[model samples]
Target: MSTSLYDADYEALRALLKILRVNAKLTQVQLASAMRVGQSYVSKIERGESFVDVLLFAKWCEACGISPGVALDGLRDQKRPGRAR
Candidate 1:
């Protein structure tokens, strides 16, 4: 499938990720520090300006104290109404 910032499901995933980070009580700066990158990296990812590959995603989940499997399930359950799968 084609991935883009405009894709509904992809956008939902990004939003969910941001929500997850917030729920974990980590600001972008904190999360970025945990991930050993600049805050701009986190901001860019949240803004969908960067594509998060699986390895990075797993690291991100780890930094947030989240299980990647659980996150994947959440991602799987994300489906916007009227959007083609």
Candidate 2:
């Protein structure tokens, strides 16, 4: 297992979160407001510069109008090109 933020799974999480945000019609700034953080924070997470913890992930899901459970349901099958940590 790896702890790198740029890993494929993490990248998938970022992709999913960005999709959910767009689907929810929320901008990065809007999601940041809902998540109680600055826009750059959300951008960092989505760009894989920041490693998001479980609580933060849950908050992000809720901010995008979905439950953490729903987000996880679609996570496992997320595939992406491999990259070095």
- Give residue 25's error in model 2 in angstroms: 0.5
Residues 7-78, model 2: lDDT tens digits: 767788888889999999999999999989999999998888898899999999998889999898777635
lDDT of all predictions, in order shown? Answer: 0.85, 0.86
Name the lDDT of candidate 2: 0.86
Worst 10 residues of 2 by lDDT: 76-85
lDDT tens per residue, model 1, 8-33 = 77787788789889999999999999
Candidate 1 runs further than 4 Å off: 80-85
TM-score of each: 0.85, 0.86
Q: lDDT winner among the candidates?
A: 2
Error of 2 at 78 (Å): 3.2
